[model samples]
Target: MNLRLSGRIRVSVFGVAILIAAACGGDRKTFAPPPEIFSEVDADAGTCADRCSLDGRSVIRCSGEIEPCPIELACGGGSCRQPCDAVATEGSTNGCEFYFQPPLLTTHNDWPYSCYATYLVNTSTVPVDVGIEFEGKALDLSKAIYRTLPGEAKLAPHVGAVMPGDGVILFVSDRESPIDNPRYVACPKGVVPAVLRDYYPDGTQLGSSFHLKTSAPVSAAAVYPFGGAASAIPSATLLLPVASWSKENILVNAWEAWRTYSPGVQIVASEDDTDVTIYPKADVHDGVGVVGTPAGVPATYRLQKGQFLQLVQPQELTGSAIISTKPTSTFAAHTCANVPANVSTCDILGAQIPAFERWGSEYVGVGYRPRTGDEHEPMPYRILAARDGTRLDYDPEVPRGAPLTLNAGEVAAFGAGVGEPFVVRSQDAEHPIYLAAYMTGSNGDYWGSGRSWQTKGDPEFVNVVPAEQYLTNASFYADPTYAETSLVIIRAKTDGEFKDVSLECLGGPVTAFRPIGTRGAYEYARVDLSVGSEPGVTSDGKTCYYGAHHLRSDGLFAATIWGWGRWTSYAYASGMSLRSLVSTPLLPK
Candidate 1:
C-alpha cells in the first residue's frame, strides 16, 4: 500500500486479490486514532508481558480494550508498541522445484573445527531427497523447511541432520589420492551442513563444484574462502535450479596474465541429459564463422541429474558458449585475482552469468564504491554480441575510440573513464549482447603479484544485471570480513517511478541508508558489514543482517552489492566482487 501523497482517500476491501493503492490525503485522517496520553492509573503488566519479544513481527493480539495512540507511534495501543504493516516481499517464481548446487565454492571455514563446504538448504513443502556426489563417491541426505513466521517472507526453519555423525562411514574411501569414479547417493530424509574433509583431506584451497540433486522443491547456496592464511576473501553464489536454466550464453572471460589462478567454466546438468556442446571464442572466425567446431571442447559430452563437468583453461576459452540438450546451470571464473591495474596478491572472481536470452538491451557501467570521488574513476566493461550484426550506441558518449559493429560471438570492451554512466542500446532485440564490468584492482602504491607475499591484484568480475529484469527489491548477503561493501542501484529516472526505498535484515524492516553515488537514475549506497556492525553476527552466532529486502516501488529498478577485501594496516591485500543471488526469475522465453 503506497502511502497516499495527500491524506483523505477512500479505502475498500473487495475480493482477496483486489488491493486499493493509497491516493492523496486531505486535512483529517479517516482511521487514525486519537493522541496517546499517559494514565495515572496502573496498567496490567502481566497481560502484555513478552508480547513484543516473544511473538516478534507477528500480528498484535490485544489482551483488552483498544487504547488511543498518537500518529507519531506507528502502531501502538496506549504506550504498548505494535509493529506497523511492513511492505510485503513477493517476487515472481515459476513454481518449479529443481535447483542447481552452486557452481563455485571457497574454503568452508578456517581450520581445526572448520569444514570443507558451508551450504544453506531451504526446502519446500513435500520434503526433498538430496544426494551429494564427488569423485566416484556419494552421500545421501533428506530434509524439509517447516513454514513459520510472516508468510510473505517465506521463512522456514532448518530441520533434520547429516547422517553418520562424523566423516567416517559414508565417505569410506581412503583419504589419499582422488578416486575419479563419480556417483550420487540418494537420501531418505534429513538436512544439515556437511564437511568434505574426508573427500578432500588436503584441506580446502580452491576446489571442485559438488553436484546436489534434490527430489523436491528447494533453494540452495554454497560459499568458500578465497584468501590464504593471512587474510579472508570469501565468495558465494545462489543456485538458479534446473527450471531456471538457459540454453545459450556468452560473455567476457576471466583470465589472469600473471597466472595466479586460472580461468575456467563449470557446468551442471539439470536433467537426465543428452548431447552437450561448447564453443570457444578463438575457434570462431571474426567471432562468427566456425573454425573446426569448438577446438578445445569435447566432441561428445553428456551429464545426468547431480552430475557436473568442469572445463579448465589448458587453452584460453573465454567468450565461449555452452549449448546443452537439457536445461543446465553455468558459472564463470578467474579462480581468484587482484584489482586497479594496481594491488599485490590475487582476490577471487566468480559469477553465474544468465543466458544470452536474459540479456538486456540497455545498461550503464559503474565502478565499485570508491573511498573518494567515485564518479571520476574509469572502469573497463565488456560487451558480447549475442547474434550477428549488433551495433552499440552510447548516450552522451565518452572517449572509447573503438569500433561499434559486432558479429555473432564477438567481444568488444571499452573504458568508461569518469564519463556519465553509459546508456547503451542495441539496434534490434535479436541483436542483444551480454554486459559485464571489471575493476582494474588497487592503486600503484599497493599493487604486486606472482609471489605469496604480494597483494593478489587480479581483475574482478560482476554481471551488469539486465535493466529490464531489475526488480525494485533485491536480497543479498554481505561478508563480515570484507574491508569495503557497497550497493550499485539503477532505476527509471522519470517521476513516480519508485517509492518507499527501505531495507530489511534478519526478519524485520530497518532504516539503514548510506549513499555512495547518485548517477542520474541510479543511486549507490555503502553498507556497514563489519563483524561488529549492524547485520553482523548476533549473540546466537547466526548472522542477523542476511535476508531478503522489502521494496515497494511504483515502477521498476535494479540493484547489486560490491564487496572488497583489505586489512587495516596491510599493503598486500586486493579485493574481488560478484552480484548477489537475484530472487526474481527471468521471464520465460
Candidate 2:
C-alpha cells in the first residue's frame, strides 16, 4: 500500500564531491576506496544517471547528462520514469471512502436491528456527490442514540447528488418504529433517514461507526436485518473501502454455537490510536471484560475513532487472528447460526473481511441453489490456514471431510453438493487461504423425508472471494427480503473459452445465465436475481429488489449475493479485487 512516486532526482554537493574526489585515486590514503570503490563510483556516475530497467517497467534515459536518478528511476520532465506504471490497477469494491460497522444481528426477543447503507454509482456518466457521517463518542463513553417513536422525525445525513444508476438508501441504525422492523427491501423512493444521533444498536460502544464519503467511485452495501420482517434475520455485506482497510485480518466464522447463539468478530477503528490485537481461535465471552481473550491468548485493544470491538464466543471464531495498529474494519459474525446443528431455524451471519493482505491462493466453491422440491443439499465449506505447512489442492474432488494439510491456525470443513464445483488450491502464494461459504438449514433433512421447499432458508455465512480476487466490474445489491434471490457467477477463461459476461438489472440485460460449474478453471454461473413473483419490485420509484446491480466482465469475475427467506438466509461477495496478496505484515506473534 505504498507506491506513490512522482518526482525525485538530485545529485549535487558539487557532484558528490567530484565522485568522492575521483575515488581517491590521487591519495587521502584511498579515502575509503573499499565499498567496491563506491561501486565504481556508482558505475561511472551511473552513465549520467537516470536508470531503472531491471524489469521495474522500463526507463533509462540520459543523453545530455544530468546525473542523479536511479533509486529505481523517477527523473522528472527530461525523461527517466517508471516511478509508477506497471499497469494493472485493480483494487475494488469500488470506493471513495467507506467505513461501516454493524454486526450483532439475528434477534427475536431482544429485537432492535435495522441498519442500511446501499449506494451504487460506479459511474455511467458523472453524477456523484454522496456523504454521511455518524461516528462520535466512545473511548468507553458510548454513544449512538436515535429512538424515535412519538410522531417520529429524525432523517438528516444524505448529503446530495447521486444519479448515475441511482440507488442511495442510508438509514444507519434503528430502534423506533412500532418496534422497529425494516430489514431488507423497501426504502427506495428517496430514502435517507439517519439522524437520531446517528443510530446504532446491538452495542459495543464508541459511536458505533459509519462514514461513507463519495464524489465519484461508489459501490457500498451493508443492510442488516433491514426491512420486511418475518422475524427478520437478514444480512448483507459487500462494503470495503477506507482504501480497503487492512492491518491484518482473518476470522472465517460460522458454526460454533446454535442454541444460545455465538460466533462473532467485529472490530472497527478507522484511525486514532487504534491498536487492536486478539488471537482467540475460539473460547471468547465478550460480555466485555476486555475481550476476555482466551483460547490461546493474545488480547490487545485501544481503539478511538468510532471505536468498536465485540468478540462473542460459543467457540468457532474460525482460526481467529486480527492484528492492527490502524487500518481496521473487520467483521465475520453469526449471532444465530444453525446450519446442521440439528437445524430448526437460525440465521444471521455476516462478512466484511479481507486484509491478511487479502488472503487467497485460489478458491471457487458454488453451492446454494436447490429449493423447489429441495434435495440437492451440501454447501458448507471452510479452509483457513495462513502459513505453517499449508498444502491443500482439490478440484473436481476433495470435499468429503476435506483437509489436505493445513496448520497456522488451521481449519478445514467440507461439503459441496448442488452441481458441485470445488477448486481449492494453496501451496503457491506461500500458502494463503481463508474461504468460508455455508448455508444449509431451512428444514434440513438433506434427503430423508422433509423439506419439499416449505420455508426455505436458514443458516448463512459467506466470504469466498478468491480466484485472486477476481473482478472486472461489479456494483452489487440484491436483497428484496429474499424469498430467494440468486447469482453465483465465477467466470475466468478468455483464452480457453467463456468470456462475454453481463448481468445488469432494472434497466435490462440479465438473460438468465445458467451454466453452473465447468469443474476447474472457473465457469460457474446460476443467475436468477429473484424468484417468487418472477422478479418483482416496482411501484413508481422505478424498479428495485434492493436495486442497483451491474456485473460486467471481459475476463476475471467472481460473485455471490444469495438471499433466502422464511427461516432466513443471506450471503455476500459480489464485489472483490482488493489485491495485495501478502508479502509481509500479517502480524502473527
Candidate 3:
C-alpha cells in the first residue's frame, strides 16, 4: 500500500476497495488519522512527524514519518508546542516571594530611624494575604503596632489588610528601640509591625534578613530611616524577589569621604552555607567591624539563611565584584554620604543591585526634577563596566570629564542637567554595564558660594533600570514625608504615545504627565505627585500615595519614584523585569 499526504489524509489500497466517509460532518474537509490507528502498526513505531496546525494553536502528529516541526515549535506530548512554553517570562521586581536585607542607615542609637517594607497589591480584584516571616515564623499582624520614633508614648494604630489596588506599609525594623513613632501618614487598620528581631543593628555585623510571601503577586519597596528626625538620612529601593537573585553582582555606590562615613555593601544569603567572595575596587579600611580587603584583593565569607554580611569602607566601592556560591540578595549603600566629598550635608543612599546577568547594555536616564527653583542642578550619574574594553557612547555627548572607555571593574562618572535626557550604550550586549543616578545634597554649594541651606531636596542614589528591563506596569509607593514627590517616567516612542499611559490613585486617574524631553527615541515625563503640603493623605481622608499604578502599553517603560524634604531625599526604580544578559560562571576573571 502507498499513501500520499497533501495538507490532508490520503490512503491507497492494492486490491480491496474501501470507502471512508466523515463520521458526522456537513463540511467535506479531510482529517488526519487518529493516534490510536498508528499505535497498532508495529512498522510505524519510533517514527513521528510534527506539523503545526494552520491556526498555529496546536499541532498534528503523524506516525511512521521522520519530518520535524518548525524551528519555533518543538515535538512533545504528541503535539507541536512552542519551546518557550516551559520557559518563564522574564523575571520582574514584583513577585510572590521576596528577601530583603535592611542596609545600615545610621549608627546613632538616639536618632529616630525605622525601616519599612511597603507592599503594593497588584491584583485588580483579589485581596492578597501577605505574610512577613522572620526567624522562620510567620508574623502576627494583629499583635503588631504602628512604628513610632523615640520619646513617643501614645500607642499608634496597627496596619490593616492590603486590599486590591491598595497598599500597606509594614514597619520592618528600627535603629535602637523596637517600635517608635510612625511618620508619613496615619497607620492603616489590620496592619502590624514586624517583630523586634527583624531589626539589623547599626554598625553591627549580624544576620537579620527577612522574607515576604503573599497569596498573590505583589510589588514591594523598602525605605530605610523611613521615619526619623530632620537630621536622619533616608534612602529607599525597590525590592526584588528571591526568584531574581543570582550568584554574582557588582556594587554600584557613591564615594566615601575621609572619616565622615563609609560606602557599604551588604550581602544576604538565601540558602545556608552560601560563600560570597568580594573583589574590592578600592582600598577597604580595616577596624570597621568587618575585616577589610585591599584594592584588587578578594575576600570570601560564608553565611546562612536569615544572616547578612556587610562591608564598609572609607573609599568608593563602585565596580566591586561580588561572586557567591549560591543566589543571594545584595545592596549598595552609604552609611551617610555627601554627593561631593566636600559638601557639608550628607544623607544615606541605598539601593539593591540586580545580578550581573540582569545588567543591560543600553540605558536612558533623566535627572531628578528641581525641588524648588527654576534652575535645575546637574545630576551625577556613574556607569560601571562589567567587562574589560567596554566603551560607552552617550547621546548628546556626556560631560567633558566623562570617561568613554572603561575596563573590567572600572567606573566613570558624569553630571547631567534636569530636563536633559541621555542614553548610554556599551559596545554590545556582552559588555553589560550598571548605571546609577545620584541627587546632590540640598546645600548646593559645590560650585558657588552663595548657595543656601534651605534648599528642599538632599543627596540620594538610585539604580537606573536598563531600557531592556523596563516593565509595562509597575506598582509603587511615593513616600509622604517629603514635601515634593514625583515620578520620572521614560517610555519608548516605539510604544504608544504618552497619552496611552495612566497613573491611577484611589482607582482614578491622578496625573497630568508633562513632557520633559523632546528630542529622543524615548520620551521623558515628570509627574508631580505632591498633594498640597501634606503628602500621602488626601483632604477627603483617603489614601493617595499608596496604591497601584498602571501604564497601559504593550511596550516596556521605566519609572523612578523620588521624594525629597529638607535635606532628605529618596529615589528608586519603580519596578524592573530582570533578564539574564550573560551566561553562567559570572565570576570576574
Candidate 4:
C-alpha cells in the first residue's frame, strides 16, 4: 500500500488544500505532528486518570475533558446528578446559541422534506434552556457567542429547555411565519408552540431558523434541504462554528444533470472586516493553475463578522479557489442534479468544502446504505486542483472520464461504479486536491431498469476529509429523523499485517468495529452509528459525548456519517480533525 500522500508527478500548480501547520512565510507546507506528540513521554499514570485510548493512534494522554464529564466514581466527582430542566436566563454558564437552516420539519408545506437542525446537550449536569431568538445573528466560536445578528428586525423568542441525556430539535420553515416575517412579530401572543409556553411566557412565533444559547457547550447540525429553491433536494451536513473555520477553500460548482441545475458556493465570514479573494478559472484547465499574473487578478469580496455570501454558477466555476485575509467557512452546492447521468430525476448535492488548511491528500470514496440496480449507476467524483499540474493517480483507475492533469481553478470528474471504492493521490506534497462523491440518479431505467422507478433513490452529496486532517478523537450528534445512519471510515494506511485498525465508537450504541474494505493504500470501515436512535459517548465510558459522539481510532483516519430516511439523505465529516480543535475542545463543559 502507498503510504505517501502524493504520487510521483510533473504537475506544476497548487491544488485545493494542504493540511498545513502555519509556516513561517507565505510558502504553505504539509503536516507534521505537534512537537509534544513526537516527545518520548510515556503514558504517565501520574497525570492520567481513566486509562483512555486515543483511538486509531493519537498522542493525548487523558486527564481533563472539555466535553461533558461524568459524575462517576473514577473521575473523583460525587454524584450531584439532577434533572437538567432549568431555563436559560441571565447568570447561566451554558455557551451561546447559534442557528443554521435544517429541513423545515415544522410545515406540511416543507413535507417530503423533513429539514431540521438537531442539537444535543453534552453537559450532564447543565440543564440549559433552549429557544429561538431572531435578532441579528453572529456566532464566533472562538468567543463562544451565538449572538443575535445586530440590527436585524424582529420576532419574539420561542423557548424550551433540556437536561443531560436529552436531545431536542427546532424546525425551520420559510412559510411567512413569525420567525420568517417580521410583520407577524406582534400579531398574536397565542401563536407560539404550546410546548414552549412554560419556557418563555412572552414568546409567540417560530423563526425560519433560530439562534440557540445554551448555558453549556452543545452539538448541532443542519440537514441542508435535499432539494430547495436554493438547492436541488434537501440534504444534510454538520455546522461548524468560528472555532472550526479555516482560511483556504476548495470551490467547485456541483455537477449538473439538468441544464437548469446551477451549482453554488456559499461562505460565512467568522470575523469582522475579513477580505476574501477568488481565483476563478477563466476556462477549463485540467491539472495546472494560471501562472503568476493570472493568479493575482482574482475577484475580491469582503464580509463583515457573521455575514455570508453565496455564489451560484454553472460548470464554468469548477476549479475556482478562495483565499481569505482571515479564516472563513464555506459550502458548495447545486440546486439539484441527476446522479447516474441518464436518470431523469435530480437530487440536491452539497457539502462543507474543508478549506486548504484543513485538507488531506489521501481519501477513499465510500458511501452509506446500499446502492442497487444497474451497474452503470456510478459514483460521480469531483477533484478540484489546489494548484496547477496536479498529477492524479487513481485506484481501480476511474472506469471513465478521468483527467490526467488539472490547472488551478480547474475541476475534473469521472465515475467510480457503485460499491467500488477508489483512492486518489497527487504527485507533490504541496498540491492536494479536494475529493467529493455523488450518488446516482436512478439509471438503467430504459434497459429493463424501470423508468418510473429509475428516479434516483434520493441522490446525495458528500465530502471526504483528507488524511491530512485525520484524527483520533471525534464527537457529534446524529440526525433524529433518519432511521439509518452509518459512517464511512478511511485510514491513510492499511494494517492487515497488524491487528485490524479499529475506531472505538465509545458513546451512543456504536461498537468497536473493524474495517470491511482494505484496498490500495487505504483501509475502509462501515460503522453503524444508528445515531438517530442512540446517544453518543467519548472514549471514557462515563463521559457522555452526547451531541457529537466521541470517536477514537487505533490509526489516523477520517469518518463521515450518512443519514438515509423516508425522504431525506445527507452526510458530513466528524469534527475531531478540524484545525480549530487543535487549541480548543469541541464541547467545553
What is the TM-score of each predicted model, taking all chains together?
Answer: 0.57, 0.28, 0.75, 0.61
lDDT of 4 by residue, 78-158 (tens): 111222221111111122344343322122222223223343434334555554443353322221112111111122232
In terms of TM-score, the best-performing candidate is 3
In terms of lDDT, model 2 sits at: 0.59
**Best lDDT goes to which candidate?**
3
- Scanning candidate 2 in windows of ten residues, the lowest lDDT window is 12-21
> Which of 2 and 3 is ahead in TM-score?
3
lDDT of each: 0.39, 0.59, 0.61, 0.46
Estimate, for each residue in 421-507, the C-alpha lDDT of model 3 and write its tens digit: 777776667778888888877776434444654767777888898877766667776655566777787876442344344565434
Q: Which stretches of candidate 1 lie over 4 Å from their true place?
A: 1-192, 198-221, 226-233, 283-298, 338-343, 372-374, 399-403, 417-420, 443-459, 493-496, 505-552, 567-589
- Local accuracy of candidate 2 as per-residue lDDT tens digits, 39-154: 11133443575443322223445443335445444332334443322211235666667777666633445545554445354432346665567665212101221111111122
TM-score ranking from best candidate downward: 3, 4, 1, 2
In model 4, the Cα lDDT at residue 370 comes to 56
Q: Report the error of model 1 at residue 424, Å.
A: 2.2
RMSD score of candidate 3 (Å)? 18.2
